[model samples]
Target: MSIIAFSIAKIYSDSALNDENTFEETEKKFDKINNNDGIFEYKSDGFYLKQNKTREYIKWIEIESVIYFDYHILKNVNSTGIEISTSHKIYKIHNNDERSMGIEKFENELNKNINKNELYDSEVLSDGSSKTPLYIKSKI
Candidate 1:
């Protein structure tokens, strides 16, 4: 167990996950959590989620899990923001109501893509366990 000097979340522009190949050319932005790619799409080949143009292609199959947490604040949150948990790291995505892009829209799209890809939503157990491909709501 050494140490990870830079393990911050990679922000996307939503376009990073348009359909799949449509976003292969999307430049992966980095630099102290710069908001880059939008939305998140899974390509048969791979997807980009980093802060570098040279190395940000991530294979879809490589993704072991995806946790969507958009419950920030009803008013404070500009539309919506979510964190995608992957095997490597967590990616941060923020969207606003501009251009008809809001939290509700993004959330629905995210779910559609997940189901289309045949992914399994993990469930976070009360014992502190975890899982999701679908979506786990509040715990009470």
Candidate 2:
């Protein structure tokens, strides 16, 4: 009975968990990032991340890694996050945060801009709370 329940949950999660954003959607978000009015802003050279009221500019060459993953905040609310690691600092961007640029757009740009030293992809089931653990970490 538990196996059957797990199968059903896996199927449901596979169908419901979608994190990819269309190019059009990401392009529209590009406008916002270009406007330079948010927690995250994009530039041709790199990007700016605003944290604690201070804006820090991160150059593409300084990035060591980028990890993309999905996570759930509640039963039905699922979101994605992008974690960028530099030599001395780690920055995180959450899709659900209103103050930030859309994570999808940032991620898409990251793919185009940076060269990462190490790439890894995996699913991390935060807190062991999610039954299906739908999120996967991709090098995106």
Candidate 3:
């Protein structure tokens, strides 16, 4: 998960704008990533998984409040597969290093344009539970 987090952070850092258009641009970038070879595709309802040549999974997660750019490790699994579990939503993953590099580069740009503290913050969930804060420190 750290790799995914790092990857996401890298993407955000590369593209620093928080405007409404950012989401669309990110999606387009993700589309390019998914089309690359060596990346297997699987979908589950609204969830999608893209595995690299090593069979490790990188994900583009979309929930109600936020869109997550990350990857996860699948343990004790079988051969590579792609499955779609939902009808209303679609998800995908990209297996290309070039695409990942693009995301990383975009994140770098975002990091350069925005202040870490201003972009994200630690806060309590609606359930009244407090969560650990993630602070983005400036690399510039």
- What candidate 2 gets wrong by more than 4 Å, as runs, is 1-38, 77-79, 115-120, 124-140
Question: Which portions of model 1 show Cα errors greater than 4 Å?
Answer: 1-43, 50-55, 74-79, 97-140
lDDT of 1 by residue, 1-140 (tens): 12332222122433445643333334432221233223333355655443323335555454444454334343354223455555676655554433222334445544544434455554555544343344422223
What tens digits encode model 2's per-residue C-alpha lDDT throughout 30-122?
676655445667788988888767889998777766666567667787767667777879776665667555565666676677543444446
What's the lDDT for candidate 3? Answer: 0.37
In candidate 1, what residue range of length 10 has the lowest lDDT sum? 1-10
My TM-score estimates for the predictions, one after another, are: 0.35, 0.53, 0.22
Angstrom error at residue 31, model 3: 24
Root-mean-square deviation (CA) per prediction = 19.0, 11.8, 17.8
Ranking by TM-score: 2, 1, 3
Q: Quote the positional error of residue 36 for candidate 2 in Å.
A: 9.1
Best by lDDT: 2
The 10-residue segment with the lowest total lDDT in model 2: 128-137
* Per-candidate local distance difference test: 0.43, 0.64, 0.37
